[model samples]
Target: MDIDDFGPKEPTCRMLEANDKRAYFIVRDWNLETANSLRRVMLAEVPTLAIDTVEVIDNTSVLADEFIAHRLGLTPLIAEDVDKLVDFRDCDCEDSRCDNCSVTLRLKAKCTGNDVMKVYARDLVIESMPPSDKLGQPVITDADGLGSCIVKLRKGQAIDMRCIAKKGIAKEHAKWAPSAAIGFEYDPANKLHHLDLWYEGDDPKKEWPADEVRIDLDGGPEKTDEPFNYDAVPERFFFDVETVGGLSPDAIVNNGIKVLQQKLASVIKELTGVDEANAGLDGAQSPAMDGGFGNDGYGNDGGYTTPGYGGGNAYAGGTTPYGATPYGGAPGW
Candidate 1:
């Protein structure tokens, strides 16, 4: 029998709602540790492209050199296939700044009109990049073509610079963070009373406004009027993930899962002194662990296969059978 049948059932995600930059989903069968790990990975471990170095060629605008450089470093550059790019440290280059490791963008904006002109992120131009590198496109927040405002310039003022975007995670700097904010809450109704919430006014609900979990997911613990369950435990989780246009919300969740799997693989290797990836291939029996350690999360039920994962992807681009419910189990509760 397959080893996955012996361990924790894999956790599954049902996408509640999604847009270009945000997604609402619910995860089931995951313990507090696994759920919290995924949340932290999405916030920190998922790699994305961001501006790391800024070289100001010339600046006559009101903004100082340091200020302009700082603004340039914070611009959100979009590269949908960011996983194809290698991080600077992992590249084969002896020194940093190679076609494989870095992407260079140029910004040259001047105020030709008499009135003050606003220089936006769209003003930045993709100067040079790797052969397969499609990086450093400014994210458009609105239809006005004003992506993210860099700096304003008066008439006869101008700014010129070159920016370098590299692969990185949010742990290094906020510039590389793909998410704006991640809403992680299990019991929104306080029926669990996980925390002894303090309230000064008449009621606690009025003072501590419910988070987006209650407002969004119907599957979440939003039924405040229902009877408080004295015997309930925090089993389900409501995740409202808002990304910053760097990676898709689907990708963020998928990537987080992969990161956890990798960590588990390392632990397995250290404990058993055997490579888990090649465990059963040689007709040698290895230890059976949770379904989370399996390559494909499905319990091999009906020959069901996982989708939305190929290269360095965290999620399948399309819907999977795992959706519509928490589907399976994982290592712990």
Candidate 2:
């Protein structure tokens, strides 16, 4: 069946607020499942570049190599055009390291004389450019210099390491998560009626942000004559997304929807068994061929074969397939 048969063909979305790192929107005509799927995908399924493995060539600092490597893996990298990047598992190269699947970041820092030095994310430089033009730099940076400070160094301390950044889902590790948080709530204004606001002071509106307080004064009843109504409109959800600076909040949301679409398409393909090359053939047929056998027309013994040949059946007299002794019966039982 076509996907449109499941629900509305096209859902409507209205942007309530948006910025570089955060966004708030309202989705209409979609079920709770759809909204929650988007939320989970944004938080855990959306792929982003992160330092997965760190190789410390030399470390003269007081910190252990394992600790330094752990810190490196937690640092988020800039990932703008995620589609252009290839996942490490999908890359053609057989080895664990490859240019197409990973980017190398090098860091070499040392403190001289009485000077105290600090290593930051910016200090670690991308060895090569990513494939996409949209991704100008692999390291996330701003006017404040680097995105975050990695470690501090004393006058005689030094650190040298190579970090490998690869595309990964947050399910494998949280460092790959694109969004910091994704959540949604039912908008009460869509159906709630007789909403009333009572606050002290001359101007009640001044107490809070204008966007925070919203009352539907004309939906069902008068506020002065009735208690507050708690009803909500169905199929309407207000969503909020916060990014971890790897990508813009809008990009995270869009990528989440795209990932969900791809997953659904894969499910549909598996269920329909529509092989593009072998169209019109029976798709329901099992791929495995049945070998001639004694019982079920296949080689499977159904656990009835003699011991030392195949394996004894579950009700066998000597020993069951799981090594348990059968109770009160011959091999047939």
Candidate 3:
């Protein structure tokens, strides 16, 4: 809620409505950049537990190992303490698998009766899963527990497998995604002209109808309307987020904000390092980083142009100077 920490403008987001699967909110006093950043981060940055690797000990089912594995990967998992788990690649343990970074799921099903049996997501039993009774399983929509039919088995068909779940983000693989869908919109009325309606006639109202939500919220267009303001900007953003499972809509938004904060903090840290390094070199000047343009850059008072691409920056010589980053240290840039 203390959005001042995220930006200089001190924007705030208010939840308009929310439920188990979906949430609606509005962010005020912010620009398009910040609003879009939240949307993208929510889509691809939020972490979740997914079946990354599968071990098939025995399989007599019709589906191939790869096919069954792919289905299991896309199944929505309930990861309550996903943050407590670490990425397998980042774990410090010597072993390839451990409790710190890996979860084991055991699934074994066989059809004994004459009737055909179906395998469901609920069939996958949680084993070696971290202890977290605080977060109970979601309400099962039906007897199958909202699990789609993975594979059907005849009288003797059977399957035995153990799946390995790991922590990951949607950017790497969509199986780790938490959000089902997210709707982001700003300036819904289009008063700012960010999107122009291309209609055949002069009055576009006949062909293009106004958004019902806008009409309802703003009352009749004739009852109350404000003239277009030249200084207008995207100061309010509306968001509606839906989650697949485990993570609530509020949690998804909060986690996305945390990821965005970390990214901004990283950039700030890198910039601070650059600023310090830029100040260390004595009388060193780089037109690129320091933004000095007066009498030093190409074809100045001497009427002589600098050679090579980028003209007078650190890349002019096609080599990095001082063994440092392009923005910090050295005099070429």
How many residue pairs collide in each prediction?
6, 1, 2
Candidate 1 lDDT over residue span 246-326, tens digit each: 777877776666666666666745543435334322221121234443454423433224432234222222233223323
Which 10 residues in a row give candidate 1 its minimum summed lDDT?
A: 279-288
List pairs with backbone clashes in candidate 2: 303-313
Tell me the whole-model lDDT of each prediction, alpha carbons only.
0.72, 0.68, 0.70
TM-score of each: 0.73, 0.68, 0.74
Best by lDDT: 1
Candidate 3 weakest ten by summed lDDT: 278-287
What TM-score would you give candidate 3 relative to the actual structure?
0.74
lDDT of 2 at 163: 86
- Candidate 3 lDDT over 45-76, as tens digits, reads 98888888889987899889999999988877
Tens-place lDDT digits, model 2, residues 1-333: 654365534578888789987898887777678888888899999888888878888899878999888888888777886656678888898864577888788989988868667788878777756676545244554787666778888998899998888889999999888888886676454334223556688764566344333223113222466565554334677788988888899888877876775676566445433322121112112211232221243224553233333344323332223234333244767
Q: What TM-score quantifies how close candidate 2 is to the native fold? A: 0.68
176 in model 2: Cα distance from truth in Å?
Answer: 0.5
- Model 2 Cα RMSD, Å? 13.6
Candidate 3 — what's its lDDT? 0.70
